[model samples]
Structures are given as C-alpha cells and as structure tokens.
Target: MAGASSRGGGDVAAAALRRCTATAIHSGADPAWSSRLTRPRERDGMVVVYGDARRRLERRATDGAPAVLRRSTAEEEEETRKKVTGGNGEKGEREWRVNVPVVGGHAGITIVPLFSQAVPKANLADEDIKAPTKRTQDGGTKVVQAKAGKGSATLSMAYAGALFADACLKDLNGVPDVVECSFVQSSITELPFFASKVKLGKNGVEEVLELGPMSDFEKQGLESLILELKSSIEKGIKFGNQ
Candidate 1:
C-alpha cells in the first residue's frame, strides 16, 4: 500500500472510505496523531501506527514477523543497536533488546516508550533509560536538523507507514496474530484515543492490549504524559469536528 503525507489527505481519504467502504491503515505523523477524525467510522478497519522507524524495528524483532524470525539474542541485539546509533564499538560491552512498547500520542512527552519491560531485558541504569526516552521524543527534530530544515522525516515515516500497512494487509488476508502498536479509540487509558499494541484481523483492530507492567520510571512517565496526550487528542477531535 502506498502512503502520502499531504495535509488534509486524511479528510479526503476518509471521505473516499465512506463512499467505497474501503479500509485504511495510516502512519503519517499528523494523520496518525489525529486518527480520531482521519478514520472516524472505520471502527476496527482504521489502523494508525506512526513514529520512529527504530520503534517499528524493535516491535518486528519481538513479533517474529519476518527478517530475523526468532527474538534477537542479547549480543545480536547489542550489535543491531550499535549499528542504528553509530555507537563506538559497544557490541560485546553491553547486551539489550530494542523492546520499546511505545504508546500515547506521537509527540514529545506523549510518546511513552516502555524500556523497563524490554525483553532479553535491558540492564540499564535510570540515566541510560532516560537518555533513550528523550531521544525517542526528539527523534523527529534530529531528522529535521540533519535535513537542514528542508524537509521532515519523510523517508523514515514512509518506511514505517509501509511497514504498518503491510502488517494490516497481511492480517486482512487471514494472517493470524498480526499485532502492532497503533493509536486508536481505546478504553485502555482514560483518553479517547491512544497508541498501544493492537491485534489486527480481517475486521480491523480485533483487540487493544493493555499497557501491562511498567517500572516506576515508566509509571511516572505515563502519568506525566497523559495530560499532554489528552490535550493533543482533544485538539485533533476539535479540528476534525470543524
């Protein structure tokens, strides 16, 4: 499935979906952030998963979708981590998996990564976790800086968009247990729309998984983020209604 990042495309796309009864899976940063309106009546058919490609890579590692199949061993994960960040020869020095269960909205503070729950397990100090959390929050800015303010994170976002779209299509075509993190109208949190791991099927979002267990740091992060995420969702809803 092709993806576009044009403004108001969600409006046009949703209008088309209403007419043709077609489903949509979106990963545009703006559209996914504002999915309540982008896919108003889609029910389970509208899937929104947008943000860092790193996050998607992490999810794919654990979900056993393709490429690497079984979960990455600590050593392998460390190597992969070094490759992504250009870390200075830290492969054998440390071992950790990229198991970030990102949630909430797709913006700073709103984007909550559950490093505490990461598998193969991350034996990181609070400072280490804090650094990645902030990095995830400001990932877009780093891209924008690298581009010299010419364009946003088009390439990475597109890759992430296609990845999510492929997963949705696979689920629609009867692939079982197709799960991914997405922002959707949910009761999992107090907010009307939140991003979390969702099970996909022919019908769409078959299930919205809970946030499960979190470390004290993660819990604090979640609490601090809720207000901002709620405001973002409210803003999207207000704009959509207009």
Candidate 2:
C-alpha cells in the first residue's frame, strides 16, 4: 500500500477536505470523495484503521473484537474491545469472536449502520442480516443475555465502539474511498436521518453519499423510516431549541 497515498494522524482527513472550500480550487479531482470526512490517525506506522474497520464489521457477530474508541486512549480502546465477546464464553466456554462496527452516535433505533453494504455485501434478509445486524443493533440485548441477569451489556458494546472508531481512522488515512455504511446525517430520505456508505475523509464526515436506488421493500422502508426519522429529528431539534 506504500506509494499509494497517506497522511499523518491528527485530522489529516479534515485538512484534505478543507481544500474544496478554496474559492479557486474547483477542479473535480479535489479530495471530493464526499466532503468533510476525516482520515485515520497514524501511530508507529501500524495503520490501526484497517483493524478498526474489520472489528467494526465483525461486531455484528456474537463475537465482536475488543472495544476501541474513536476518541480514547489506545490502551483503553483495545482493553474495551477485548472485554466483550470475550471470556471464551461463560464458564470458560469457547465462543467465537466476531467483530461488528455499530456506527452512529449510540442510540436505539437512532443508530443506523448499513449491514447490506458491508465490504462484500452479504446477501441477507433482515433476519439473516438481522443475525449480525440485529445482534449488533441489539448488542445490548446480547450482553444482557450473557450477563445472567447481572450487570448490563458492557463488553460487547465496547467492541463495537472500537470498530466504528477504527473505521473512521482508516477512512482518514488516505484509505482510498473508505466506505462504511454508517448512520450519520444523510439524504436517503427527507428526514435528515441515517443511511450508509458515507465516504470518510479528513473531516469527521466527508460525504453523505446516496444509498443509490431503493428496492420496492427498501423504498417502502425508506418511506416509513423518513416519517419516523423526520418526527424524531423534529422532536430532538425542537426540544433542543427549547
């Protein structure tokens, strides 16, 4: 991957995104992969970005990698990811670790990372996709289940926390159109809600790229989602404004 393209860790992606703001910098090749996304940070030249994305994606499975945070110390991040989907299962039972990145600010339903567009794009319905997607979405639920009705979903959630953090890192490191179906400010609907495939760059959120055309089911889902999304945003905004 050397000689491809790279940048230093701190807000490198943001620096690249600022290029488009220039009054005279209007060519097309400007790091316009979707303006405003940030690149990954570098440390000892290890490239933590890839591992982050991989873990983020893996979090959906019952076994997600250890937790790594977007804005936390490295030691804390790794410690977190390992906590969940950990302990070799209960009673020292062997449990496979599958990392899954649940992007978007944490919130039930509000958080919407796209599993359909995952790297290879697993051909799965909501249920099949749900297995991972839902598991990730409800990573909390899994934790509660594993807790034996004790504490709460802590470890696994941390794993997802790290994966998402890493994905953002990778995108910023000149990762060539690093695409993650994250749930950020988007235009898939009129709601200003979450969708996927946002091109990460120098900024925290480079571009809110389209979700392409929706299938009939997807279209219906989008339609309904917008209504709910709009309502949610309006309520949040209105409440915040007040």
Candidate 3:
C-alpha cells in the first residue's frame, strides 16, 4: 500500500512539472534561469567563440566608413585568418584551430554561445565570436552589396559548403572534443528549444550541459538578447513553415 501511494505521489509531481513547464513556454519565459540560482558546471553553448580573429567586427562597429568599405575590411580580416597550402605542397600540412559554431538561422548578431551550456568550453574572445556573427547575420546583405553589376560571391557560398563538409569529416575521425555551435531544439529556453553551443563528435552531440552561471556582464547580455532571439526564432518558423 505504501509503495503504491509513493508511486501516485511521484506521478502527481511529474504532472505538475509538465504543466508548469508548458505555462512558462506559453508565457515567453526562459525556464532555465528560474530553475536554479547558481550553477557551477562550466557549460558550452551552441556557438563557438575563438580568440582575436573577430577584430574585423571592431572596425565595423566603429566605422563611419561606407558599408562597402566595412565589408571590404571584414573580407580582408577573414582572409588573414586562413592558411592555404593544399595544392601548393604535397608534403606540407595545414590545420586551423579556430573555433566555429553552426548556429541556427544565418549565424547573425544573435550568436548565442551555448558555451557554458555546451559540452566542452572553448576559450574565445568577444571579437572572435562577434565578427563571424556579424558576417553570418549580415551575409545576405553582403551578397547584395558585392553584386554590383557583376554576378556575386558564389565562391563564398561554395566555401561555406565545403567547410561544413570538412568539419563533418574531422568529427568523424574520432577527433577528441570536436565541437561546433549550432541552433538546437532544447529545454533551455521559453520556446521548445533555441540555438546554442553543441559539441560535435562521431555520433553527433553526445551531451548538452546546462548554461551554468553567468557573470554580471553575461547576465545583462542575456537579458538584452532574449527578446531579439525570441523574435528572430518566431520569424524564421513563420516564414519557413507557413
């Protein structure tokens, strides 16, 4: 009789939890924040943050220069980050340790790093993450900007496609701690799930850590980000499915 009663109580607790979760979702609240006060685990999110490489964005944010000039600056910076030697040397090897995330929906200014909430934490600078974010976010406009009577940067499109293939290849080779930040459906947000950091591997993401604790700066950033991220997500879903 006691065992049966305990089981019934457990079911009631579970049901209440589900209802509460649904309510939070319906009301547009990030449930993770309320679920705890301070989390100690260092988690990774759905975006990769590298170091220094994002210097291109620093210029864009400050540029009084024309949009085309800003884009030109960004392109130069991106080119600088790469190391090419494939056809040039057969005995030579080139590897890039730069971090990248497959963030959902164009990888724009909404580059929400799921770093702390992701499996493995990658050390990165704000510029590193932010620059790529701007590129991803504004890539559509970039295409428009570059196509001045001429065709376009079909080359850029192909490069991204091939980069994705390479990332997949490396992860398949049992590369330890292969990671990419991508938009993933998760229990982390008010919505069903949102984009964040995810660790890539031979079998895809093995585990997703919680978003852990945030510094005051991060907390404030997150507060500012919620509305924007939410709006973007809604826009995508509406446009894509409808």
Candidate 4:
C-alpha cells in the first residue's frame, strides 16, 4: 500500500502492479488501474479520492468568498455568528461552505470541478466560476511551487487517503448510503473511467450516480477535459503493458 499524487503517480503504480502477483491497495488522487483493472477477470474494488477539491472549497468559505457552502459544528456556528453580528445580538449574513464534485482524471486539465452542481448552488459569475475551477485543477502544481519544488502536497494527499479508507471500512461494516465522489470504471460517460458520486456498500461500488444537470459553463469544462483525460489513461495503460 502506498499513497501518491495524480501527476504520473498512477502511471508508475500501474507499471509496478503489473510485475506483482499480490492484490495491491493504492490510495491517491487518480484511479491507477486504468484499462487493466476494468477487465471482467481483473476487476477489483478501487476508488480515486481527490482531497484538494474539498480543501479548496474550505479555503473559499473561510475567505468569505461568495456562494460557498460549509459543514460546521454548533460551537463553530456560534462563534461565527458572534463575529458576524459584532457580539451585539444583531442579525447578520451567515457564512457558508461549498461542496464541489470533482470529476475526470486527476491531473492538470484532467481535474474538473462542477461548481454549478455545488451544494447550496455556487451561483457565481462566469469569471468567478473559472477562477476556482482553474485553481482546483492546478492545486498540486501550486503546492509544489510554494515549496520551491521541495515536495508535493503529501499532507493533504495523506488526509484524503485516510478519509476514503475509513469510508470503505464503514461501508463494509453495513453502513448504508455511504456516498462519495470517486474516480472508478464508469459507463456514465464515453470515457472508460470517470469520477462521479458513487454509493459504496459491502460489495464495493453499489451505484454510480449520474452527473445530473450541468450549466453551460460546466458542460464546456467537461467537454474540454475529456481528450486530455483519455490521453492520460491511455498513457498509463501503455506503461503497464511494457
């Protein structure tokens, strides 16, 4: 078992898996299996969880960015209320958080954040939508640059891996409706694999949810990302076969 980022991490893992006989458990930003694991005889339960998507949404909410949604504890809510109302018991605007479902492969343009489908509606202007979308896509690059190329987003990647593992455990223990967005072998789109909301259960992925409705902006983002994602998947498969 190992954790890695999406950029070339999955491709390397795929090649390594090809040389081994044991079942491998990979937790990272991309679905490392590619076409190999999608075969009927080689099928194994796997999921790609991108934690940066959630982190970016959290940053936006805390920064008072518009149309963001949040999940907060009662104590945190009370503290926010006091700050917003100036502790004068006056009603003021409340803070919110965003839940953006990230799809496609985990890479530069391959990462797609469906802000229009965000919870509580990210009702952002076109420019606003573009900003976060690009940020989500280039998040790993930004982290690398910030550290002067010393390391990647190892901490955040670890957190996302742990979170997904816990979800898988709960589902295996009979937890119902344990839903999470994951990159898996999907028929929801023309691509062989895609990232979308999925219901996890004892047998692994019980249901793959549809992308639902998409705003024009979101639709365009999805369309533009497919070619690059397909190329990356194919590249991984080629490496595995070599």
Please write out the lDDT profile of model 3 over residues 1-242, one tens digit for every residue: 01111123545433343322111101111223312212322111111111122232322223332321111111111222222222112323332433333232332334433222222233434433344434444553455455542343345544543444454456666677654434456776565545445566665555554556643434444565666677655654554353
Q: Where does candidate 3 have its weakest 10-residue lDDT segment?
A: 21-30
What's the lDDT for all of these models?
Answer: 0.53, 0.38, 0.37, 0.53
User: 1-242 in candidate 4: lDDT tens per residue?
Assistant: 22223344445544433333221133233323222233423322222122333333234333423332222111001111111111111223232333456777666666666767665454555666676667666665566567663555555554555556667767767889997777777899999877778898776788999998877877888898888778656654554454
TM-scores, in order shown?
Answer: 0.65, 0.45, 0.40, 0.61
After TM-score superposition, what is the CA distance of residue 163 in candidate 4 from its true location, in Å?
1.4
Q: Report the candidate with higher lDDT, 1 versus 2.
A: 1
Global Cα lDDT for candidate 3:
0.37
Please write out the lDDT profile of model 2 over residues 29-121, one tens digit for every residue. 112221222222222112233334323322321122223222221211222132222212232423334222323333334344343443233
Give the best candidate by lDDT.
1
What CA RMSD would candidate 3 show? 21.3
What candidate 2 gets wrong by more than 4 Å, as runs, is 1-137, 148-151, 213-217
Clashing pairs in 1: none
TM-score of candidate 3 on Cα atoms, chains taken together: 0.40
TM-score of 4: 0.61
Write model 1 residue lDDT over 124-207, tens digit each, in one string.
656667767777677665666676645555555655555566676687578999977777889987889877788988777889
Error of 1 at 33 (Å): 18
Error of 1 at 102 (Å): 0.7
After superposition on all CA atoms, how large is the RMSD of candidate 1?
Answer: 11.7
